[model samples]
Target chain A: MELTNYVVLATILFTIGATTVLLRRNAIIVFMGVELMLNATNLALVTFARIHGDLTGQVLAFFVMVVAAAEVVVGLAIIVSIFRTRRSASVDDVNLMKS
Target chain B: MTDSFVAPTIDWIYLVPILVVLGTGVVGVLVEAFVPARARRTVQVTLALLATAASFATIVLLWRDPAVQGDPATGGTYGVRVLGGSMVIDPFGLAVQGVVVLLAFLAILVIADRTSTGQDAFAPTAAAVPGSPYEDLARRKGIEQTEVYPLVLFAVGGMMIFPATGNLLVMFVALEVLSLPLYVLSAMARRRRLLSQEASFKYFLLGAFASALFVFGVALVYGYAGTVDLAAVFQVLAGGGTPFADMPGLVLTGVLLILAGLLFKVGAAPFHAWTPDVYQGAPTPITGFMAACTKAAAFGALLRVLYVISLGMAQSDPAAQEDLFVALWVVALLTMVIGTAVGAVQTDVKRLLAYSSIAHAGFILVGIIGFSQASLRATVFYLLVYGLATVGSFAVVTLVRETAPAPERALVDATAGVVAPGGESASAPSAPTGGDPVGDDPSPAVPDAGVVLGEATHLAQWAGLGRRSPWLAGAFSLFLLSMAGIPLTAGFIAKFSAFGAAIAGPDTQGGGSTWVLAVVGVLASAVAVFFYVRIIVLMYFTAPAEDAEGVGVTVVRSRGPAAISIAVCAALVLVLGVFPSPVLELAAEAVKFVP
Candidate 1:
């Protein structure tokens, strides 16, 4: 029943998500990693809200969910556009601009 | 034990300026849906300009309102807290909002301008595949993407709210609202469609990652302070008597994560990987808008956060405060070194400016690190001057185009004559039917057909620009020199004040000396001068490439709006440099933030 356990779990999830984003070659998978990171934050927020005996963190979790959904909409639109033109979802294929 | 339901009394006047912009954006969407296609561009432009002007006017009215100004006798801050302390309409945030609105207005003029050939910088149909027959058909039909006006208004609305909010949750929302429109706009370039899409993808991925980090940081800070309000978080950290006082590590990690998100938006080094790509790939006008307005909004949020952390730790946790300052100092030094060092080697004009913007971010950070009222004033002034020059320079960039070869020139003229009957079509045949596509041409099925012209971005292409169009070249050189912090330019004053504030340090204890940053910044300015001046030399000194080869830069004649924007920006850059006292006094009066 230690709330710290939940915080630890959230941290693990966040690290995994960040790692997936860095390592994934597919654009869609990388986007999913970003979503996973957001979800992990929501989990942390809800747990924190429970621990602190306040609704602010819980309310913030809902806002995060809404924002995550909006981000998914825009992110998928962009990825899909790139996919349509190039016929590839791989991140490496998108490299037309190099210094 | 059910609590009685009650509404929080809201201050309607405090919220009007933001509402006007967002409201105009909503109406713009309706305009796109219902208005006749032929009139949509005119309607949208007029609406957007009026809304921006109205918002700025309201801000001025609010500035004159006696109720908004706090009494210095009581030691109260110079602003009102509205929406139950979620939004703080203070002098500092108001000043930033005013600057954003004014810059957005000028940028809108650039965005609304069409070249003499009657082409804007946006794709005819943003969702259409680049080089596809459908896109070609849409272009031939003169289908302008008037929706850009709405998107800009929404972004401006978010920017207006970004610096004025005291609640962390609101700040996060404002960040998203401002950023999402820009992500889409980056991909909607009329030329170089594939590059634009790739740039949008890169910006989105990185931007989303930064946002996720920001939210996680917010969660941790909430856990530590048990509130999502910035002022409350400060109270908890400063008191040191709270139950969570032992969790300084948690607070520090959270703060760093949040700062990372914001710094990414400001395009500081290490997080500036997206800036050059996005700036070069996006439509030139959109690039100017993003460069100027986005930096202003992000820096505003950064100022609020830095102010809170420094002042909060002043009372307790001095060691943690020192650690924070050390981190900022390292970031500032790295940002300056990388921006100037790499900027010097860039071959493309847009990428060079992108790096210059990164360096400017570092200089502004120097001011922020000072953490004093004088520093606050200097930082705001720097943002304004920087925005003016950036937008103006990019406007000039939009005017400089790549001329077509002799054989393709005839084809472009033929197409232009068939497309629209106008005398202006004779000399304006620089469209991309013949030029080898910069990157892999994704859809080569449809020829570019003289509809839109790509900018001449390569440094060598600008060789004879001075001889061809002396006034335009002179204006560009002025912007570059201003950026170089040469004497008698607004950039010189901005750099002087920012470095001066950094050397002065905070008029308080606990904030460390930033004189070293000021010294490094001056040296970086010296390094940055090499590239900017190099461009000037290339433009004025270097002879025109052999015209017999038929590949040279062409300065497109602006219809009207872009010219006005450039002239205003250049004039202000000079006036502010020579007589900066008026704006400097305004900035001094507007340095106080509400908690």
Candidate 2:
């Protein structure tokens, strides 16, 4: 059972997104990283479902997108409010949450 | 794609509790937007109570229906395949739903009392227009703000669905619905001192950051597993730690990082730096609710991920899973030690309790460490016990009656409303406890009665507490004892179950742990005893603080509903402690979901 190359590429892209989230300071960039990761996941789900000849993976991916959309809207609203309140969005600059 | 075209069918019945909560949140937001200030209290509170009780009743009725002929969900562990085989329902999800039902009910009680009592006094207006009366003034009290309650319930409902969801995407949605309101509400305390606002702000900012992390993690796992259905992932991972066999190493890191983000929401160590500040800064009641309910919800989801996924990881090599378990055990260990030791040294009552909660998380982690298919009973039982105690402890703290406002920067949440500016709110006449800069006192031996006399002493001093608040005191003691793990208390039974499970080892068909960790946990608990006893000492041994430095100490009186919440939690703690079989049996019953 040979694994597909598409799966491997999608995973590498996902890793980049995750790393950006860990290392990036800019909130939007971090958010973009998250988006990239999510897109990578959708690709993997669709590709695997194609390989396995099962539709479950494809359906789950669709739901993931729907959720991603909701998260983005809410995330934007939260970031907007934090900016209004704290006047900044850099993960480190938002010191109001620290212990 | 064609499968999605069929439009994944959702079992509406399975989502009833979630819908009810969402409806409640919508109602709360509506009231916050449109209701007259004075009338907002009644509307938001009644709506919240009704929603919780109704959902609770629905859950109860689920059990009452004839098992054979009743609805498929009511009869067996009810499940609706929202996305065909991508997700399914098991009793594990249902058990968490039950925990949510209880948590929602308890949160309403705490929220209602705090809001009602603080009418005309909410968070102080920090950074108010300068050259104002507040320039030299400290934090102000808050006005009633029950609107946050229903919104919180909505989130709770979402969180409840989170662990139950078969799909990662749905789980993510549930996580957001549960968390967003909390981030907002943490900032809404009445004593809008800087600390309160800071608490909420930090909670929001960090919480948002964590959510992003979790989202990315999910995407990575989706990439590796190619589906979000937990069961399907189990099938994939069942081959062992090598579940992601063909995927690039990057995908595995994504899964672990996403887990880190989820763990943050649960306030597990390393990610837990935010716990103490937020707990200390938020209004005591809100702190309690968050500590208890939200933590439970987080753990519920965490358990599902580990047991459902990692169990397969464990099968790869029991020893490898053991190593993974060991890694988590270290995190939990640090959390327990840090939380307990720091909590023990706090001069401020709230700060002390916050640390104690941190320590408790470690104990819960102890149960979590044993998360094999067998660790299910231990984990679920421990959560039930630990969750109740956490709620109970917070209930006591909430009832203690705050004396001062947070720093001005703390009340910054109102600035974000963007709709109506929070108007001026009158302060509470005077706090029974001292929370401000105190002048030198003549009484040299006088204990910080506020710190010592925390449990029922505040109620005793200002609001007819000792006699009128006898019931509240009893309930408070029950919770206090539970935290103490006293025999015949729920806390005792819960702690026992977790430790027992942890010690039971991986094959025990319950939560198991290394004896070394469990013993360390026990020793750490002895340190916890010192603090729990401190509260009890204040309640029983210490005299109430009198007009020390002209700061009068009037006890707060508990209202009927508020008192009832305490009474019920206390009674159950004792009931479970006295006769552990039934509850423990139920915990054992819930373990089937583990494998």
Candidate 3:
């Protein structure tokens, strides 16, 4: 019943998503990790909106969904292009540029 | 049942400049879809230039409109909050938009240039695989990717509205609107497909991560303040009326997380891992555009966030503001130190400039923390000057070509006059074909067929460029000098005003500790001068080395649009440096943000 419990759950999901992003080698998986992080944020926002009883956070959540979908389009296009070229889905292989 | 649904009154005039640009971008997309391939390039270039120019003209008209003129001190009559408080049309945001538009115009000119072997820097077909038959076919057929023009217009439209957005939701969307096109554009470079793709991949991934973080920050702030509007958030913080006021921890975390995302966009240290690779890999013209316009837009948003959000809090609870100042102070220090130290050791010119841009970001942050009207004005002026120099310098970079040696040239000529191994072409006025091996040859026999040129990115390749293309070298040196904050250049004036403001600003901003940032900035500029001058020395003093493996460089014949853009940027830099008062007065008058 408490809103803080929802916040705590959202925080756990966000942490898992971030960890997945940091540890993943596959570009697609990494991208999915980012998507997961975004969804977690969305969860947090919707919960907060309910707590506040205001529509602004809900409106913001809609914006986030639209933005996340747009991001998926761009992120997939890039990862697919790289995969086609290098014949690998691994992020570690992308080492052409360094300091 | 429905008595009446009330609609929010919209201010059409307040939204016109941004609308004009976005409308032009939509028109550009239609052009891409419907226009014939042969006519698209000319039509798109003209539309883009006209759109930006018209937007600038509209901004000027708005400036002169008596209805919109308001005094900064009173925050009256000078700004119009429109779209039910989602956007603010104020002098400060307008000034930033002007800078973005002007720089976008010049960058578009460079993008449209075709004199270097009668081809632009972009790939003939971006979807074609490098070294594939399809790529060769596209090149042979002379296919041009005119989609870049529409993409640029869209990016510019987003940039025009980014700083002006009064709501966090609109700001986040605007950030993506600007950045997505850039990710695609960076991958479309004709010469270095692999590196370009790599850059695009890295930028997309990191950019998305940062955005997710941004949205998370937005959510937390919403939870803390119960509002998504910047002005509302400020009021909530100032009045201590937020439900989360008891939990100040939420507010602090939200602000810090938000700053993290913004700092990433600005290419400040600790989040600038993408800058060098992206700068090095993108088409040179796009790099220039990204460097100039992106910095201007990001700094504009940053200024709005710092000044508007913090000012209210400072007025009500001054102690709450120190946390932000301290965080920014540390960031400024790290950025300058890391940027200059890493920059000094770079072998590629583009990467060096990227580092310099990061250092410049640090300098702007100093201006932000100074927290005065003078600092605000100085920061805006700095953006303008830096944009001019950066765009002009990249235009020059596009002109210089890297050439392979005789043996490689023979192989290249053998390969049906296409690019050699590594997708490089030895662009010279004369080069021998697959004739007998020209061993130990200083100059090979003349090959009638011309070669497509790539940019001379390597520092070694630039040895004695002053002899090859004196004017270009000279222009490039001037830009480098300006970036170094040398006297009699726009960069010097930029730094002078920024640091002067820091010293004279109120003690409340940083209680005089801000002076230390200015000192670090000067010292970093001094160290930065070493690398910049080293390049000048290499260009003017050193001879082309005789190592067979060393890549020789060619200075491509001048293209009209790029030349014109360079000339305009150079003239603006000099004029601003020597006689900066008019612009300074204008910026000073327009430096106030409406909160």
Candidate 4:
């Protein structure tokens, strides 16, 4: 398979993830969408690294994974605290301040 | 083919400032783990402040280093690249680092301050549900939030690294490192827990999305240039070192995406959906810190990126350069209009300040669009003065509190036939018992600790503040006037330099269209003045709202730190306004980026 095809696949997944983040009501699901978008970027980075014959992209992917894990730790902790108080994880329900 | 591994030689001395800050953060975390709870706040505050001070001293040392000063004959500054060119300590980056450290120190003072009641701004137990028995128990036990100091130090460390890096990967890491602590901090407000958490949730999700786009943009740029190093990418764009140079579409798309991420941090319009909400909901001190330091760091990074891309495009693709200019122009115009128009209507003090910050971001963008050394100096100066005013204003906000009414006093005043200044019967049954008999005294009877509520953020609550506490009102008025760009205040000089830079224009670019932004910025300042002046009038001219309902504003006496921060900020604003040449010269000297 052509390497460009990998980029195309990544783009499709990224779109799906972005759309989910915008449209999904559940905060957890929205966070999952963020994760998906990140993973899609990882795929693209690795593919680009293969094409470039350099280690930078691969190293960046590893960094992204670590950051994503850190995000999960902070995100889940915040979500759980909010969930305990309101008994709901819906983003719409979280609206206390008028935007 | 097997290759022998070679470790990259590092410059340890040049990396000292960043290391000291990040190192302090790690030790701070260790302090949290090992130190006894009673002694933790003192230890952490001392460590964080001293480390930040030491870091600033190192930056000063670097400034004087002959290597950094470069050759006097050339009249050019040199940047030191460390860690295989991942980080660059250039004049511009160093100046920004200094600004961030200075602002962070002041913000930490506000964050560390407790009211005379011995209540700090953070929740006793952040994990406990608001209003729950556990929360009450923690509150009663007076369990101080010693952990906040460490979190703030880590955030400050990330902020220092953010503007100094030349590698996209490292920038991404720095972005996350800075943002994560802030997300946690936003959720830890002692009052308005729900709003705080919601702000944190929104900030995290949106921040994550922006960074995702940023990383993807890095991937695309890497695909085109075969490297994530900014200097390398610039070289490829300028000299066509890559086969993909012909595909400007991919590179431009990536550049815009990366810009989106940076713009989000700066709270520019179209990407600023989170700023007002987050600023309004976060604890006031954290809001002040985020507003001042984050914007400076983001602008520093943005300036570097724009300089590289524009310089490269000038050499290789003038058409692309024009396109970039047009894009920036539109964002600047939109940001000014939205910030001014929307900000004029906000009733909540915090939200009003948030919108004002947005407008200020637009003014800074005006300086940026000029794309010259003069503009760069002006932009840096604007950031410094704006930061001082913001931190000072928010510090003032932290001291203003809402007092619950004392029912007995209301009845007593009613029978006495005493009427307050606003024609509202001062004697309404709901008047606070601890309140003075006249009801006009700005100094409320220091209510019992339990009765004192959160910040008096409602605009109506601030009525007749000048009559209550003249010194605080006077200080707050100075910040507002400075923000309004009135004469003889720091803000006026800042606005003047920024607009002047835009009007002067860079020699390479036709600066005609950029002047339109300056005109619009001036007009926006006029519109912005209305709101700022309205607040001043409300504070000094309007009568205190009839507290017959018992929710009057009271100025809480700080133990010491917040007051000192405010006094320093106010004094600096006046001094900078009066004599800006020294700082302007400093900025002029520091305008070069390492590229």
Candidate 5:
């Protein structure tokens, strides 16, 4: 399997994730989109590490995973906090401020 | 051959300032766990202040020592590269770190003040649902949120590192460290809990996307250069020590992607949709902190990219340089126009200030894009001045409140046949508190120990504030004038230096495009003055309408930490404005970036 092909697949996954974030109304779903985007980057990093025969990118991937986990914790805390108040996890409903 | 690995050289002294802040933050967390709830706020406040001050002192020590300057071995023109080349402590980074610590200290003063309401800006317990019995009960108990103090220390620590890290990976980590606490902090407002949460959510979701984009850009850049260390990447991009094709496409794409993340952080346009909402919704003090320190950190990192990294690109490929310049120019132009044009019409003071911050971001970008030594010095000076003014102004914002009358007051006024200027009734109920489903309830029956007043965010509520509280009004006006770049103010020096850099930069770039930036900057600041002056006008010129006294707005008079912070900031702004030469010389000396 060519390492380059993995990069292509990762790119596709990243697009889907970004699109999901843009399209989804549910805050949880949008959060999942963010997770997917991060994972896609992880995939790309790993593939680049393999292609280059260097462990730096692979180490970076681990860091990304840890960061993503942290993001999940904070993101869920915020989403849950808001959800408890509004009784919904929809982004559109969170509109008390405007221009 | 048997593998033998040796430990990398460690420079403990170079790491001291960062470790001090982070260590204090950890200690604060432990303090949270061990200390009695009643004693927590005091201890946390002391710990945070000492840590930030200690870090600042350490930075001064590091700055004075010639042995620790860059690399003694090769006469490197940067600070000590420590943590196995993950961080640097050069003069530039140190200056920025100093600014961060100073501003953090001031911000902490504002954050810690409790005299006005015997409650800080943060919620007593962030986990409690707004308006829920749990929240009301916590409020009744006067449960102090000492946890925010630790979070602030951690955020400040992250900020200290964000602009100083030598590697992209560490930069990303520092970015999150700085950002996460802020997201949590924004949600912890004592009043308008729902708006606070919404702001946090929006900041989190959008900020996550920006982070993802940043890491993706990092991956691509790593792929292009085969390394993440900035110096090594610069070497590769500069065309002497690389193993990849010299195709500009890969590198340019990576640069743009990374810039997207950075630009988002600085609240530059196209990426600025979140700025107004987040700034308006966050607690005022935190908003001020975010407006000031975050931009300085982001711009510091940006300067490294442009001066150290992109300088290599420009030398190797003129076309790539032009592309980068043009991209930044468009973003800067849009930010200036959008910030001023939209700011002109905002009725909410916080939102209006938010727009003004975006405009200031544009002005800073003009300096950044100019890519000269003058620009660097101007940017650092501008950041310091801007941070002081911002933190001070927001302190004043927290003081002004619109009176929330009991529901019966509206009925009494209705029966009395009274009308006032900007007519309804002089006793017209405060602007419909939106989404506050319990609006008719007047004020919460939460039995807290201090005065409960609604945030007077409406511009009309500020009428005759100058008459009611002259000193507060005067201080706020000074900050506004400084922000508007008026003469005899700190903002004037910052804007003049920034525009001076922009004008000087066109000669090196071989195009007249940068001159356009200078003009836009000047015009934008001019437009900005109208809105800023409008606030002063509303405060001073408009008399309080009949029966509106104490009903429309009241300035909370408290000789608390917030007042002290405001006084110090105002003094600093005036001092710096009048005697800028000493600071300018220092900035000039600290202008060098380590490649």
Candidate 6:
């Protein structure tokens, strides 16, 4: 039951993130969505570790969290800078690097 | 998080390079966050340089350690299996990584120089002369470009980890490690305005999707194999007792999905639609770095996944594997054909090379299809040749960006910054053109060039570069030649080795596949020559368009790191082209830990 609940929660968070990333206009909001997905992955990883009775999974999860944290710090900084320069965070509003 | 599990002992000696890079990156960020804006550039460049040098030292140490020699066990093939079976240390990983790091640094140098025009090379002045608009231009375009180095190091750390990762989880981490920074960096180009941001967003969305696909594939493969250990998968296939036919569909699906994800990273044909736009829009340095390092790492993982984990199954069930190979062959050929055809017509240098890289990916995959762990030696060899040449090409591209005087700053301030009394400024001071006894005027009567910045087109701006900066032009020419695979250059040697290795197929210990694909590879490469030379002809032979700025003349001069990076990269390409054995031998032995 515990395992199932953890997975369900992870799924819910991931879905929410996906929806926000797809639907939101704010670039920062999309970034938040990305963060949500990353966090969901972390939770899922820990849940798997509990199920497996192994600490390796947990260690791996720790690294994931570290990486995710770094990413957010950098991503948020970049987004903020872009916001200041371009003055709008909407995806539709920004179209510079498009291929 | 768990006390019960015996923690794997940390090997700082092996991991020292990574730590050094991360440490430097963090320091660089702090430097940015805390330092006054004027002094930040010095902190950024110095921190980046020191970190790179330290990590490079660690890499040298890691490369020399006898323990990592030969084919050490990979943490296992399922990519999620821990420790031994997923990632194997070998010359291939080390060689590719070195290429990645070197390429990353070159890009840092390029962005630094190109974006810092007119301002003090390192530090930015806080205020501008009244009515002159010099300060305003700097704020809008030059100096303030301190983020380049930190982002470069961060990307290097990711590239280092990308290929060295021993497990699927680590691989995913490595992918994002490099990618997240890239997504942000993409939006920061100084030219092409909105298109740069668009590249970042598109790359982010696609990259995220690919990551999702990759993870799902890993889960499926784990589910089917009942083990994430690559060795176990190999053992199951090679040891011969397990019945693989029972779940052929699952295995096939898992492998394909995994391939798709890796392919996305490499910008292989079906997934390569974004290359042209992104390369054209973002800062040239970043594009060069992404094209070389990211492609190398992605291919590194893909090579390991397909060749190492899936080979056993392929050998066991030759039909399934051969069918898969055939499907891939079609894609490779199509990519080659399309890339060559498209590249030939491109007027933009960045877009042309973008297509060229796409074609090169196709050629490299052909090398992959011809490779097997049994002939693993050749695979690594081809990767080296390909990796070096690709980075070398991008380095040249960075050098070609035109340098313009900073749109901000009084010539007097710039002169003071450069030819100051003692050269004791906290950063790289601008060339003090202030000694120009002739052009020194403090009058707004000239009308601020900043406010009238109506059409400072890159191409039009660079029309008379030969007359203005012949040294930059000459260096760019060598780079283009090297890129074109001309004789007496590293590109030629690199391409020669790849083609030779591919045709020799697998291990060339007397008996190999005789490289039937060499002819096709050669022909495709010949097709590529049309465009490589076309760009050269245009650059060296054609005159800048009349009145310039016909939407094509966009030449932005690089001042600091970008200049140094181009010089270094160009030197390396020429040097390596003439003398290729030492690096090759080092790469040959980078896998001692793979037993």
Best by lDDT, which number?
Answer: 1
Candidate 6 A-chain TM-score? 0.86
- TM-score of chain B, candidates 1 onward in order: 0.92, 0.80, 0.92, 0.92, 0.91, 0.79
Which of 3 and 6 is the better model by lDDT? 3
Provide per-model DockQ scores: 0.57, 0.20, 0.51, 0.48, 0.51, 0.20
User: Lowest lDDT 10-mer window, candidate 6 chain B?
Assistant: B437-446
**Residue range B1-595, candidate 2, lDDT tens digits:** 5555555566666567667877777878878889887688788878888887887676554433333123555345433454463333455666666777786677567667732233322333322321133422423333445556676777777767777676666777777777776766665554433345556655654675576567656755665665666776676665523345555443445556667777787777888878877886666666767777777777777777776666656544455455556667888889888888877776655566667777777888886675444456666666666666666656655554423122222221222111111211211122212222111101111233231112222222323233434555556666767877777776776777677656776663443436667788899888898877776666665566554332334234456555566666777777878887886776665554522
i-RMSD values for every candidate model: 8.3, 8.6, 6.5, 8.8, 7.0, 10.8
lDDT of 6 by residue, A1-98 (tens): 66748756876886797788779888778877777776776676566556555565566657667766766665566555445434456766554322
> Which whole-number lDDT from 0 to 100 does residue B1 have in model 2?
50
Per-residue lDDT of B1-595 in model 3, one digit per residue for the tens? 7778878889898788888888988998899899999999999999999998999999989886654567546755677888755788888888999899999999999999976467788888888655566666777788899989989988998898888888888888999999999999999988767788888999988888888787888888888888878888888877867667556567667777778878888899888999999998888999999999999998898788777667766766666677877888899999999999999999888899999999999888888778888898999999999999999999999887655544354443343212222312232112222322111111222243234346767788788989978888888999998999888898999999998877776545445667888888889889999999999999999997653343446777666999999989988888898999999998896786775
lDDT of 4 at B259: 88
Question: Which parts of model 3 are misplaced by more than 4 Å?
Answer: B71-75, B315-317, B404-450, B507-511, B547-551
> Model 2's CAPRI class?
incorrect
Model 4: colliding residue pairs: B406-B432, B406-B433, B442-B468
Pull out the clashing pairs in model 1: none
Model 5 interface CAPRI class: medium
DockQ of candidate 5 relative to the true structure? 0.51
The CAPRI category of model 1 is medium
Candidate 4 docks with a DockQ of 0.48
Of the true interface contacts, each candidate retains a share of 0.72, 0.19, 0.57, 0.61, 0.60, 0.14
| Candidate 4: stretches off by over 4 Å | B1-5, B74-77, B406-450
Q: Please list the residue runs of candidate 2 whose C-alpha ends up more than 4 Å from where it truly belongs after superposition.
A: A1-99, B1-8, B30-39, B63-82, B85-87, B114-146, B239-244, B247-255, B316-320, B372-374, B402-474, B508-513, B545-548
lDDT of model 5 at position B142? 79
lDDT of 4 by residue, B467-559 (tens): 999999999999999999998999999999999989988757655667888999999999999999999999999999887455656788998
Instruction: Give lDDT per model, in order.
Output: 0.85, 0.61, 0.81, 0.85, 0.81, 0.59
RMSD of 3: 5.2
